[model samples]
Target chain A: MIYLTLFWTFAKVGLFTIGGGYAMIPLIQQQLIERHGWVTPEQFTDFVGIAESTPGPFAINIATFAGIHVAEQHGLSPLLGSVCSTGGVVLPSLVIILLIAGAFHYAMRHWAVRAALEGAKPVVVGLIGSAAFTLLGHTLLPAGEPFHWAAAGFAVALFALTHWVRIGAVSLILLGGALGLVLRCFGVSL
Target chain B: MGAGAEGQVSLGRRLWALTLTFGKFGGITFGGGYAIVALLEEELVRKKGWLTQDELFNIITIGESTPGPIAVNTATFVGYRLAGVLGGVVATAALVFPAWLVIVVVSGFYLAFRENTWVAAALAGIRVAAIVLIARAFLRMGQGVPRTAVNAAACALAFALVALLGCNALWVVVGGLLFGVLWHGVLPRLRGRRAEGGAR
Candidate 1:
């Protein structure tokens, strides 16, 4: 029963949400935390923070963690829960993509399809831009607090590295983690 | 020995190759959808001869317009093209498998050490790094798009709608699709027809 719920909720999330993993954050939070009472908001936030830092899709990370937590509540092992949840979240994507792919060849050659893609491309760019802005907002602007200057500096430096130097994503993330640990040792609040 | 037997062997090889390729993609790609797309271009187009440049762009557009994460959606499309339904299934599974392991392992460590000041500090830094990575993806995608005035206006409009006006991202995408069809697809045809009539 717990597994079914876990799968169903995430399937719903995957099916309804568009854009990407970040776009699903609010919905996941609302459904899992507020609606389902699976985990506390605090726990969900932790998962989000960690998921953002991890490799792979943010949605999958959150679903895995949430699944483990829910499974623990049902007296099941975390491994079983993780599989159930991850399976649930990805199932919708797998089905949906298969259906779309089946039709992709036929639909792609149409002039209308080309035009629609042209119109949609800029919007996709804008959607990506919005995602960036959201990240900036979350990192730099904590609620009821002044802006974080250090975070801003880190962002600029990292952006420059990404834009110009062509550093790998894994290296950048590891470097940031190391910097964070060093900052902590130095008594910085981070 | 038979031709059919040889075909089966090749089909099996194709499925295995598709699984390996997308599996690697899912393992390394961070940030989210757009970053995955950028990496796919680098790997599938520039390095491998699997997809031509135009096909990559076309498939990416399809992935974006469809529901689900772009990375997973793209994997299914590519895998299906390579090896049919089973290929698609294999690719999607292989892609998510690595991340599933990573997340589960991290969840265990996180649950154990979440209260540590050291962990908190590290996470805070990681949070900022994650944002920068996503920003990088946005910049990468932006580089591909031609910088035209109409595109600029549409971009601004989309940003405002989603960020400020709190509009759904899907509606914004739909609006862009309509704008694109009208401006690039429909309007040009109308103008061409008018010029022909004038000549007559």
Candidate 2:
């Protein structure tokens, strides 16, 4: 039953979300939070935090965490629950994408469809923009300064480094980690 | 599959195009999806002519819903658009390679090297930069958003549901879709009838 639910939600997200992963956030959250109740608002908040804090895909991380939680709660055995939930969410995307991989070349060229997409483009931008501000509201300008200066600096440097210096993604992460170690070595606690 | 690449540009040529497309997107694409989308427009549509504007638009819409990053979806869409099945496969694999490699390598050695003070400071700095990057993307996106009352309301509802209230994203989207369809379609038509009746 839960598997079916996961598939349904992801399918809608996968089928309708035309812009890609980041665009699915509000949609995914709505499915998981409101309809399914797989996670609570606070847990959703925490997951968003961890997703941002860690590396790799944010949506995947959420799927993993949510799957694990659902599985454990339902007494499906830890491994099985995690696998089912995660797999359920991801499977729809894999299947539909692979199947539609080729046939799309022809059927997707209509003008009305183009206008619909043009409308969606800006909506996606708003959704993505809201995601960033949503994070800032939590991390930067909370009820108070909750501001961790070092984290802010690290993000800025990385942005500048990647932007101006043209360092690669891997390089920026490594350099940032190295900088973190240096701060800790001197007991800077950053 | 599908007789590999032949005719028009030869399968080999298409394959090469697939690789180069992802390779360049991989190397460039600074901030995230939004920035990458612009570059994708330039290279794929304007320069390469690999896809029409309508196709590109549809691809972005489909890409948004899939489990991976927007960039990944774009790559897969283009690859598929250009070279049938294998094109999508290679494009996805290549698109994921750079970021996955970066993350995997970092995760592998991070714990061991994380104790250094300079390293911590730098990571802290990077986080700030990430926020800045996100900020820039947000500002850029703002330029495109429709300033209509309906659109504004949708953004607000989304922000509240996902951000402050922490409502589920599915519900928010469903609500938005409902609002979009009803507010734009049904409401105006009903209002039009009322206005016509008043004129009568």
Measured by lDDT, the strongest candidate is 1
Span of 10 residues, lowest total lDDT, candidate 1 chain B: B1-10
Candidate 2 local lDDT, residue A171 = 44
TM-score of each model, paired residue for residue: 0.81, 0.55
Top-TM-score structure, candidate number:
1
Candidate 2 residues lying further than 4 Å off, grouped into runs, are A1-92, A98-119, A137-145, A149-190, B1-14, B17-60, B66-71, B99-110, B113-122, B145-147, B174-200
lDDT per residue, candidate 2, A36-118, as tens digits? 78788877776555444444344444455565566656766544544454444444555567666555545447443334444
For residues B121-171, write the lDDT of model 1, one tens digit per residue.
777776666667666656656666789999888888988898778786767
lDDT per residue (tens digit) for residues A1-190 in model 1: 8877888888888887776777788888999889999888888888987776666877787888888888988898889888887887788878888887788778868888888887776677677678678767866888898988878887787777767886666566667777888877888755
Displacement of the residue B115 alpha carbon in candidate 1, Å:
3.4
Show the lowest summed lDDT stretch of 10 residues, model 1 chain A.
Answer: A166-175
